[model samples]
Target: MSDASVFIAGPASWNQIVLLDRLPDPVPHMQFAEESWETLGGTSAGKALSLRGLGRTLLLYAAAGDDDAGRQVRAALETADVPVHWARSAETERHLNLMTRRGARVSLYLSSPAAQSDRDDAALQAAMKASEVIVLDLAAEPQRLLPLATATGRSIWVDVHDYDGTAEFHRPFLAAADVVFCNADRLDDPLAFLHGCIAAGASLAVCTLGAEGAVAVDAHGVEHRVAAVPVEVVDANGAGDAFFAGVLDARLAGHPVPESLAAGAWAASAVLRSRHLHPLLDPHLG
Candidate 1:
């Protein structure tokens, strides 16, 4: 863990991805999937994979159950060479994601992992204190460990996904985060929200805009934007996570915000061109 520069804590799951021409309408109707497969899921896993692809040294801390699905998830990460410290949970997290070719998705969570013990906390806390940055994805465990994370005083990065800007659950994460990322999916005004985040003391706030690209606001209140790299879309499962990883990696290397955004756009293309969370998972997809 001493070699790891980034420490990530969140959910890691085995997931089934079903692709269709478009997101299924909210109705009871049968539809055939254009393609379907099982692979890794969970925002934290995605970030870990992407960061590994970027040649970054990182340690991932996540909960996994003593179940077959949990074994699959753990094996997959080990195969990808993503170092992880696992916590015992009652069950592994699982999700059924129905996605469109153009990237729209509706995720159905099959199971939520429940921590079985607090034995992993001592090690996780040590890793956090040693890391340069601590990334806490949206999960109950990380949320519960917010105080410890804040105490470390390292840079904290968070991905809120499609935050609507009023959820009580997200406030603590937003408050603890130095850098924040989200998509424009549910927000009525993404730019305004970014501004609000800056006003609230975040060093930076970014909103990804699917194909149009991404936008950001720095601590100085200057806005930055980047055009998405055009690519033959395969799956959008982990693009946002990839983008988050890229930006963090670049920033840590002393790149400016605009350059970091470009790095993020490029990183996302790797996932956009793959069927799995990251290209490193391709050989282990089966």
Candidate 2:
């Protein structure tokens, strides 16, 4: 047991990223690309990696395949000194992400993940019980931990990712989180959605608006706003996760909500300036 303070649970994907001028239309027989790369990507991985980079003790509980991709995922985390307890499945979650210069992305799943039986595992249960913070992502496997998370009285962070506020799968997660992070891509009124989160039980609610900035409502119903930090965006894949990690780290350090939001903006800009999920996460490990 590493006694890590933060616990993250969800999918960890092995992705092939192809940089193109733009995403191809629905019509077939189209091809255009500038470059490509392979990397580890998923909401859980992104958040965990960024938090670790911010100098936090991170413990990740996730599932991956027994294949080479899974090996890569495990090695990357281990090399970064982040302890991970991974359930070995038949195949890892794999994706082919087609991205553009403007950060537009179309991800195609190459292989679907197999069902994993780690929710009831002893090691994962121990980690869950010991961690100071539990971050649950939108995945079927992690839903079982919601009840356990509720029992902890520790902070529970959940990212609803571009929810339209009506998905049945997201309701349990929304209710389980002490803090909720979301993006404004799908909702016409993000502020209303954030307010709804607070009403639903979360003490804090944050909404990230791509290039514009981010806004948050604290437990006292005070709205905090911060503009996005300017950076030359290389890839938009992990910016949201970076933002979430930053705000979480700041809050954990007892920073004010406005200062925490500013920290988030700063972290997100660092991701935008680099091509990887966390710029130093990969090469530093290598």
Candidate 3:
């Protein structure tokens, strides 16, 4: 914990990934999966893996069930040498992700982790206090600890994956964040929203566009853009998280916004070529 550069509070789940030709329509029907497998999946887990890949020290705090699925997630992170503090949950989070070759995904939550107690809250708080950056991903635990995170006055980074800009739940996170990242999938106007985030007090705001690239706005009201590093897409499950990790890592190293965005694009490309969250996890996967 003493060497940890960042503290992350969010989910770490075991996911059954099913590669499909296209996302299924709303009608009730069955379709064959092009391929299927289980692996570690969750936004926080992805960030942890990528951060570790970049040689950044981080401590991840997440809830896990007292079950086999939970153990699988825990073991994978341990093997990756990502230090974690696990809270007991009634059930470990699990997702059935239906993805396509073109990068479309529809995730079905099979199980969601529900923390059984607050026994580890104090420890998480101490870790937050010690770390230079605190990343509060969109999850129940992070939401619960938002006030504490604010009190620490550490730079708080939040990723609101596909925030539509009007979801009540995402508002608090948007407001509390010093740095905010989101995808353009649900945003009607990503650049406008990025500027909005800047206007609302975020030091930096980023919006990722799948193939077109990403756009960002810094506190000085300066807009920056970076094209995606073209790559043969393998799996897009963790690309955004990887980008977030990259940008944060580069910024921590005192790089400016444009350079940091390029760093993020490169990191995302690395994940885009891997089947798992990051290439570092390839050897660890059974």
At residue 21, what lDDT does model 3 achieve? Answer: 89
Q: What order do you get sorting by lDDT, best first?
A: 1, 3, 2
Q: Write the per-residue lDDT of candidate 3 for residues 1-286, one digit (tens) a residue.
A: 4558899989999999999988999999999998888899999999999999999999998888879999999999999999998788888999999999777898899998753356666777788989989999998888888988999889999999999989999999998999999999898899899999999999999999988889999999999999999999988889999999999999999999999999999999999998898888899884
Best by lDDT: 1
Overall local distance difference test of candidate 1 = 0.92
lDDT of 3 at 64: 89
lDDT of 2 by residue, 41-98 (tens): 8889888888988998888877888899888878767776667777777888888999
TM-score of each: 0.98, 0.94, 0.97
Clashes of each: 0, 0, 0
TM-score of 1: 0.98
Native-to-model Cα distance after best TM-score fit, residue 113 in candidate 2, in Å: 3.1
Worst 10 residues of 1 by lDDT: 114-123
Clashing pairs in 1: none
Those runs of model 3 whose alpha carbons end farther than 4 Å from true positions after fitting are none
Model 3 quality (TM-score): 0.97
